[model samples]
Target: MGVRPPQNDDDEPDTITFGIAALDAHLERADVEFPVDAETLLTQLGDPDIPYDATGSTVALSEAMDKVHIQHFDSEQELLNTLHPVFESYRERAGNSILGQLRALLPF
Candidate 1:
């Protein structure tokens, strides 16, 4: 993870740097680091005691990410064009993985 001075009060003290582990690896391969502090914001995401499910969390996180990414673009059309497929792909794959895990844990 890359470290940098805080941008503003609204920004996390530590940024997750490029989103998630997978994204981090990809960015690292590309010789880039976005430096985001996902840890600081995780509590805001859900209760600690609740068992974490990547599928559900991915959708929620993706939505949150989309909101921010959408604002980054100058045009609404650009935002939609970029986010739509990415959101859909994440939803499908993450949803499938969650379902698979759920099935594996079932007695049946």
Candidate 2:
């Protein structure tokens, strides 16, 4: 985890870096294998509206998941347990992204 100094009072005091290490640690604890690369998955989770331009990837959610071969989870609890940390880390940075919006709706 990393902290970014706020540029202004409105800015968040801390910024979480949702990079490979964090993802790997979470996955290791969850005991699950995600076929997608951490960076790619994080990018998608962070900004669904932004096109994944590295390899001309589209912005469509289904297309992106398909490209990464993200299939079913071992169980719903496992999925939530694995993703909750990532979501928490990204809460401030997410802004209007899908995860951010969902976070607003869900107490968890």
Candidate 3:
């Protein structure tokens, strides 16, 4: 078990704590650094960031983002299930993402 992670809870299939304090500090720093995904979508919709004009009414960009927020967690479980195999297929794809980069830089 050289370089193996210690078990934290038997209930969990895996436990890989890089350590609470270090992981928390890294997470906080990463939070501020990651870009919001929808910003690009909004920008592409229009310059001056035109609000989302639905079937009959105009909705502000903030309102659109809010609407998206509500829908996000609603599909979390379903999305997780759907994406599980995709994630499993490209285990290293995550390594190319921001979190992966941060993980690579961790001293642990």
Candidate 4:
């Protein structure tokens, strides 16, 4: 999933860049090479606030990255694989909460 775009038209991209099958968006810049450290990724991508589920739940990408024990990732896939369970746990936690249930019902 992706966050809402900036209201200003100048911030919009002209091209349609999306995946056929995906969960969350905003990983990092495409130009960044792999085999990178957490610090480097954090520096390059910034600590973006990303959604964990459709109920408007969110976690800082840096926070999720903290749960990963690895010092460096061989590839983006490896990093994602590592964080998958962490995201799932957060999602499950959110889903199990009473407030999360209400938020899911009413996205306000």
Candidate 5:
């Protein structure tokens, strides 16, 4: 085997990190410059799969970007701040999905 992600004691299958945590991959890309326009950011990011909630399900970065009203971001911080609530809305919606309701029945 090659390198592995650090494991959690709870033994979850995926290390589901959301919000700014999920943007690590996008932010690290050299092609993405700050003060970027929303459309350009979406295109450059290539619509990454961002972990949306505790269930480890995901929504595309493009999906979140679509709901963002801001035309441009002066810095990564601005982008993150704007998307934070957008991600939360997706999380809330996902939590209300049938599968999420089914998961709620689980004792774990």
Candidate 6:
């Protein structure tokens, strides 16, 4: 049988990996302080009550970006270009859960 989907969104473990290398590189280039280190950032993102909410249960893209001081962008496209991959990676690694579904439905 193929892989089964999560029965309860809450039951699904949060296993999303933040592409730390890329994130660090980007932050370094931008001369921005990484609000939280890779490990802490991942832990915070896994929590469902850290202020940012996307599906009412996960960290919002804007919130995460803002945490790292990523407020200004040349354009909407530029912002998306910079962060889409990271969000996508989070969803992909997070697996089939309500959070992932919410991420898919909501615009980052």
- Per-candidate local distance difference test: 0.40, 0.42, 0.34, 0.64, 0.75, 0.43
Query: Global lDDT for candidate 4?
Result: 0.64
lDDT of 3 by residue, 23-46 (tens): 233335444232324454334333
For model 3, the superposed segments whose C-alpha errors exceed 4 Å read: 1-14, 17-74, 92-108
Candidate 4 TM-score over all chains jointly: 0.70
- Summarize candidate 2's per-residue lDDT along 1-108 as a digit string, tens digits: 333433556755654333333443444555544455545544545533322221122233333334433355555344445544444443345545675566557532
Candidates arranged by TM-score, highest first: 5, 4, 6, 1, 2, 3
**Candidate 6: minimum summed lDDT over ten consecutive residues — where?**
47-56
Clashes of each: 7, 0, 0, 2, 0, 0
lDDT of 5 at 76: 88
Q: Which candidate has the highest TM-score of all?
A: 5
C-alpha lDDT of residue 4 in model 6: 29
Error of 6 at 16 (Å): 20
Q: Model 1 compared with the native: what TM-score? A: 0.28
Q: How would you encode candidate 4's per-residue C-alpha lDDT over 1-108 as one tens digit per residue?
A: 333432445575433222210222455433557888988877777766656665446677778878778879898788777777887788789888998778667634
Residue-level error in angstroms, candidate 2, position 98 = 21
Model 3 C-alpha lDDT versus the unseen true structure: 0.34
For all predictions, the C-alpha RMSD in Å is 15.5, 13.4, 16.5, 6.3, 5.5, 13.8
Better of 1 and 5 by TM-score: 5
Off by over 4 Å in 1: 1-56, 59-72, 98-108
Off by over 4 Å in 2: 1-72, 92-108
Model 4 residue 67 CA deviation in Å = 1.2
- TM-score, prediction 6: 0.31
Model 1 CA lDDT for position 72 = 42
Root-mean-square deviation of Cα positions for candidate 3 versus the true structure, in angstroms: 16.5
Candidate rank order under lDDT: 5, 4, 6, 2, 1, 3
Off by over 4 Å in 4: 1-24, 28-30
Q: lDDT tens digits, residues 1-108, model 6?
A: 012233455676543223333343344444543434434444433422221112323444445565444545554345445655555555455656766676677544
